[model samples]
Target: MVRGAPSGDLSGKTVLVVGANVGIGLEASKHFARMQPARLIIACRSEAKGKVALAEIERETGYNGCEPWIVDLANFASVIAFADKFKREGGDLHILVMNAAIALPVYQPTIDGWETILQVNYLATSLLSLLLIPQLVAAGRKSTVPSRMVIVSSGVLYWLTPAKEIETSLKPLETLGSEEWCIPNHMQSRYSESKLLNLFFVRALTDRLRSVTPLSTIAVTPGFCYSQLRRVWYEKPTFSFVKIVLAIHERLLAWTAEQGSRQLIFAAVGGRDDEENMKGGFVSRGRLVEVADFVLSDEGHRMQDTVWNETIDILSGVSDKISPIVRDYLVVPDSSIN
Candidate 1:
């Protein structure tokens, strides 16, 4: 069981939880709403589903500050539009949670031509984070309280293939939007790889923000939780046996969504006294833990640097208005890039 709740009051602050329609995101949204934020935005791809979630959260928590916003991570254009709209009209964002993620039982490519898991979980996620840095920074400057950007990473990242191996297999930077590199049989591996990328992104972004911004960027894993994340795998025809095994495991071992979301809540709002130490660190089960050795190795650092540069290059092409600081952060010694 998780050990803490958000220690701070959210009065007058604006919080946004992306992909909050179901699972851990939904539960986390409800948790945040109860803290009495000035405004709570529940962002999802489906406005209909998002509205339903918005209503449910308000009904259950009696926190009427919640509203729904549309953001389809599978579509890069949608991500761009959402960010642009938020920048233009959304008020200062004190807390931003990148909690939405997808896991596919079968490989599929998004309209953007990148694999679905990669697009929704990593690429578009990186795009939105870069686009919103200016707002987070602005909000951080004005608020007496620390502003935060939380990335919902997973501990399963440790089980993924080595960074160098996965990088060589995908050569993602070179094959940005191409389907030729994605294999149908590799869907599960791809999902794990995406989560690993989340860790890398958190580390890279935290390094960039250290000297320039007060915004706290951190990553946390909710541990193994029973959530809708695995529904697709269970529903698919090819996985009936796998579904049975998962059902049994969930019944006996997995934490309920609400139980699991505590980690998210804690990571988002707890440990305020040590927020600086939490930056770029990985939290699991409500405690900051050491990262896997592979993630700290020399090769691992190279992998993170490569992913950071490639991500910036991709998002820069999509939106020419990226913040100057974000662009400059991607600038590393030429040796680092190679």
Candidate 2:
């Protein structure tokens, strides 16, 4: 089991955990409630699921202050509406845990005209994280302390390599979302590739946060827990072989959801240096670790810039607030100046 998180009193802090309706997200939200936050917002896609999560946290932790809010990562409009609602009425937020993600074995498109996994796991997640920066900054300034954005990534990123099609394409995001790349062969690695993009976003965002001292972000891997991430594989008959292999792997190495949530708790409410080191760092198990070896290669650096640029350009089209958020709150890397 992972060690416990360093104790911190969150009597006046506002903690929001997106995708907290189940699994690691639900476990993490329950842990945060024990810290006695001023307001613990449980962000979920469905109102019923959110209410159930809130009730569970209250019953388990005896913290009745948790609020259920619908924040659907599959829809860009829903994400933007939540962020805007918070901006208008919500107070400063201290810890934002972005733990919502999906794993689909087929090419499923959201109503927004993008692949389901691509939008939920990358594009919409990126939009919400960037959009909420101003609120995070306000909380940090108010307390004269730092705020954290703990984005749940995965260790599987290190095992996968980007397709030649993606690596060679000038427009990586477009190429990724193209129907040509969503075939069976490519779908096998869709979730892994999305995790890779998460790291790249962290790398780029960490660089941008250099200009904003009040906020720090880190991407964390829960290290293969028994979670609902593989629900698609179970529900889809075509993935039977894949499911058998995963069940074996999971029974052999997967941690309990509570055990995995420990890493997120530590990242969200760890010691001073722990939080300070969150500047785009990667966490796995219970400690900070280096990113993938591929991520350190020259090709990796170039690809990081490409993913960052493509994502930002797309998000700028999604919401006009993105470009200004980059300009006013973040410093663009020198390589992206053009």
Top model number, lDDT = 2
Q: What are the RMSD figures for all models against the true structure? A: 2.6, 2.1
- Per-candidate clash tally: 0, 0
Shift in Å, residue 102, candidate 1 = 0.6
CA lDDT, every model vs. true structure: 0.81, 0.86
Over 4 Å off, model 1: 163-165, 168-170, 173-178, 210-212, 237-239, 323-325, 328-338
What TM-score does model 1 achieve against the real structure?
0.92
- Candidate 2, run of 10 with poorest lDDT: 329-338
Write one digit per residue (lDDT tens) for candidate 1, span 1-338.
56655555799888989989999999999999889999898899897998899889989999998989999999989998998889887878889999999987666878877778888989888888878877787888898756788888888877665534456533555453345556565554777778788889988887766464668888889988899998887777674777888899999999988878888888888777787788888888887888877788777777787787787777778788665657544343334421
Residue 283 local lDDT, model 1: 83
- In order of appearance, the predictions have TM-scores of 0.92, 0.95
Q: What 10-residue stretch in candidate 1 is worst by lDDT? A: 329-338
